[model samples]
Target: MDFVFLEDSEWKSLGEFISTKWRNKKLVILCDENTETYCLPRLLAENPDMLSGTEIISVPPGESSKSLALVEQLTLALNDLRIDRNAGLICLGGGVITDLGGFLASVYKRGIPFINVPTSLLAMIDASVGGKTGVNAGILKNQIGTFNHPEGVFVYPAFLETLPILEKKSAYGEILKHALISSVENWNHLKDIGELDEIGPKEIITSMQVKAEVVQQDFKEGGVRKILNFGHTVGHAIESWSIATSRPLLHGEAVAWGMVVEAELSKSVGLPLEQFVEIEATVRNLFEPIVLKTSDLNDLISLMGADKKNTNEQLGFVLLKNIGNPVFDQFIDSEKVLSSLKKVFEL
Candidate 1:
């Protein structure tokens, strides 16, 4: 609920910011191997005292680490470490770290305070702020999770400097999705930006504001919030499938491709052809399209059926009517969904 954005590479400001509230409390640092190496050093350097009484738990990086088994391992580790109800958790990484850590904090001791220090662009813009935390169940993305708001969210844009190129590109999918569902002005602004790699704090803050406003209005995701999932329903399926098959597409990579497929679906289901073509072109230009084998299409469809958003044995999706406009809870038939997939994959 509380958000702070940092401009520099050093995390001293963030360390000082949270120190007063958490200095005496038991602290747990939930991070991935990537962040532990690339991002954690700055925090420790800026505030040596910050990690004094803290316990650091590092998981392997990437979506594969977000699993029930890891959760069980983390839970047991937390118990063994004797982190109690009054403990505070600091989630210091990307989407996987924030999602798994937030979920752990929610379930541990029936809930404890946790602050998100989002080091990845995707987390800063989407995952870390949403209060939705969970891991994949088998091949289904976010099939198990809870709605638990963080005590605070610290955003340090300097972390972007160390981010891998692919990861930054992946984050653009969410940024594009945000623009599409936000306002025509937002979409236009992003469209005029020329290059995704050139996106700066201004653009990131604009996307965050759009997301924050929607989250403030629909925290529980019962209505308006569902629009934020415009690309995720299909995106998650492709992500989970990639993870299961060892293809390992980044979350935003799958999302970029999903937006393309879903745009095609929207057209098949009556979205204006002109709008769909423009949407498809924009998304395709922003991200490299993921190629799904013909044989894997059925499995992707099955994965989608297992999405948490689905209801009453139907596939529920958030689709676009146009840029900056989303229609949620639309049910599309399997055949139509297949058609869309084939359209995107060229199968």
Candidate 2:
């Protein structure tokens, strides 16, 4: 219920961040060295007083940082600063910062308030909004986590200007989900904003709205939220499989392939083949179609079996009846999931 986006160019004002608002008692800004250097200074300069006398902390970057080691480090940092009960955490950066920092805030003093300023597209449209925050306990992507809705969220498209092209592409994969699963209008809208510079705040926020509303209805992901995981089942597995090998796929890339495979799976379930074709074309046109060998597919499938959504000892999947409508919690025929991979890899 505390979710809202900031408007006006002054949305990035750091000093004003804590003032002229319904913010908590005190704010503790969390960022990594990368965002701290590139984003914080400019933000602080504009809203000088908001962060005055506030402690800003930085952690290491990359997926590895979403580990217990990093969480321990952050806990010590908070203890040192005496950031106690009542102070809220403001996470700035991509998913890692928000996930790890938000987790830290959750465990710090047994729970406190937190806010999100997602700088990357993945975080802005998905991670930052869901309130699923945590660090990887081992090989799991989000093995140890808690669902703690941030006090507030602010997304700036300008933050993406410094994002690497790969990272930008990663975020786009999620945006594609917004369209394919819920609104074909969003799918059509994506044609105009393929490039990062071309992406506007309004469009990004709109994309987020689709997801936000879904989660608002099913915050625990008990029902409607499952639609949001349309491609994620296979995607997360592929991502983990890819990471375990010499090559690691960024989250977006894996999901891109997952969507392709699921689109085919959709067809096998009676969704017209044209829907499949459009899905394949749209994803390949946007992302480099991943070509996994027999071994990679085997490993990926093995990983998928471990998915939490599995029921009746069978794979449970969500596929589209058509664009703009998603059917969830259905048991997809195993052969369909496999055969579709053949078509996907043929590309």
Candidate 3:
């Protein structure tokens, strides 16, 4: 996928892309209520010539919008708008918008072109770059999805300014995950930052590059790309559990805790004690802990069993061998998993 880091004159490139490549295509912008309010106006003002006739589709903000029910509603909306196969979709929000919009574009009329305009830091670095699109199955995260790339990804770092403080902090979990899985140099660069405000566009681009490189090597996630799931196996289960509770944890918050738990699991695979300590400290420093009850353990485990990453009923994981090195497709027995989960939560 083509990536454009929209800076001073770079915004013009997005307009050029639309005007030249999708000039005659019916354009639609898919965003959440948040972006429709904060971002859509700026986008339209900046690219009036190219996006003049573009239609806007807005869903409510947050993870709940990622559901098959929402997808069906969106399909009907598109049909009502008379959007045809030749239309183009612009995903213009965080992960949920991009994931849902991409999935809709892929399935509508057997696939129409889509572009990603990632408004949130999380979407810019992870969701919009991976070409992975899907919605949740009930409380399960991304249980149904597809491997579909957008025609291009347009990243505007300035959009992050509109995010709430918590939202900005939440993205750091994914940033830390990328650094841990990529190299020691990247980890070192990120490990010391005390505030989310300390992270600038350069750090954001670095994280995006890490994901983009990994995706290029394993677009279908058949092998090498599994390393990117380092925190996600346990993270996803925690996220699913939190979603069902009154106090839902943001995706990155659960991931931060997952990295801590998985770092403990890394011990069984020979990860050095010192590295594990650093990983835990770094994650905990950036994110508040999620209080997990002993009663919650069984449910969390059950959620893991339903994860698509498992093989033959065994839980598959990507555990760290070192700070920069990850080992994927490691199937750990329930005994060890239980032990690690218990130990991490001090249960």
Candidate 4:
């Protein structure tokens, strides 16, 4: 319920917020190599007066960097630099940095105030605000993380200009899925948003509000929060599979495909058939459908079996009562899921 406007205007408000939240504390601005080069310098330059005692920090990028090895190193860095409970950590990149920064802030001196400055659209909408922070453990994604709230999250669409176009569209997959599973309000926002090339401040603010409402309703995801996982249950499985393979897909790309497959599966389970078709059409128009070879699908399925959401001899899912309303229902058979997937891919 601790929400703040994450916008371009508020970029320097970050320093002011930090100054107020952790008065007289040191600032630790964290970034990855890419964001350091592209986004961090501009960020630091914006509020030279605000972050007077700030130290710019960087780590090698990627989900792989979230390991215990990195955490220990960061802990050492903080200690060496004399960072104390009075200080704050500012994450100035995408989800990987957000995750690592959140974990470090939580464990560093038993928790310190932290701010999330999510640069990517995906991070802006999904990873940045939710308080779900962690690193991948072996094949598992976010297997080791925490559910600690940030002091505030600052989302600047301006930072998005530095992002690759593909990553932008990929983030759209999550935003679009939000449209599908949430409300016609979101649907209209996407449809009327002029061009996919321009998602403006309106859409960004709207997306944050939508997600904030959901997170507030179910912070721990014990019930209604399951809605947020609409595409992710299987999408994450694909994530693990992709990482294991040489051609790793971005998080949004896997979710893009996963949303399509699950929509088809929903129909097979006796939901209205048109909803599935509607879902398929919407995605196909936005993203080119990826046709997985039989072997690749097999690999993907193997990865699905390892999902933490699975139960004894059966899979669990949060299916739709209808679009905009999600429900958590158990007893999904793997064979039935595969059958539905075959229908979508025709593989």
Clash statistics: count for each candidate:
1, 2, 0, 1
Q: What is the lDDT of candidate 2?
A: 0.78
TM-score of each: 0.84, 0.91, 0.90, 0.90
Ranking by lDDT: 3, 1, 2, 4
Q: Which ten residues in a row have the lowest lDDT in candidate 1?
A: 305-314
Give the runs in model 1 whose Cα sits over 4 Å from its true position.
Answer: 4-13, 237-248, 267-274, 290-303, 306-315, 338-347
lDDT by residue (tens digit), candidate 2, 1-347: 34657443666443354674535567788998889988888667766766777789888888899998878888888888888887878899989999998898888889988888888878888889877888897866789989888878877667777878888888888888887887778877775556645667776787788888898898888898999888887898788877666668888888988988887787755777777787778777787656678656556665778332342245778888888878898776455565677778872
Candidate 1: how many backbone clashes?
Answer: 1
Off by over 4 Å in 2: 12-17, 21-24, 192-196, 244-246, 306-313
Residue-wise lDDT of candidate 3 within 122-173, one digit each (tens)? 9988889988999999866789999998888888887888989888878888
* Candidate 1 global CA lDDT score: 0.82
Please give, for residues 56-77, the per-residue lDDT of candidate 4 as tens digits. Answer: 8899977788887798899999
Best by lDDT: 3
> Please, what is the whole-model Cα lDDT of each candidate in the order they appear?
0.82, 0.78, 0.87, 0.77
> In candidate 4, how many Å is residue 26 off?
1.3
Deviation of model 3 at 68, angstroms: 3.4
- Per-residue error for 5 in candidate 4, Å, reads 1.9
1-347 per-residue lDDT for model 1 (tens digits): 34555454556656775677776788889999989999888777766866776799999998898898999999899999999998999999999999999999988878989989899898888888878999999866789999988878887888888998888888898898898888778877877774877788888878888888899999998899998888887898898888766468887888878887888887745678877776777776777667668888778888887442342345789887776778898888776787788877788
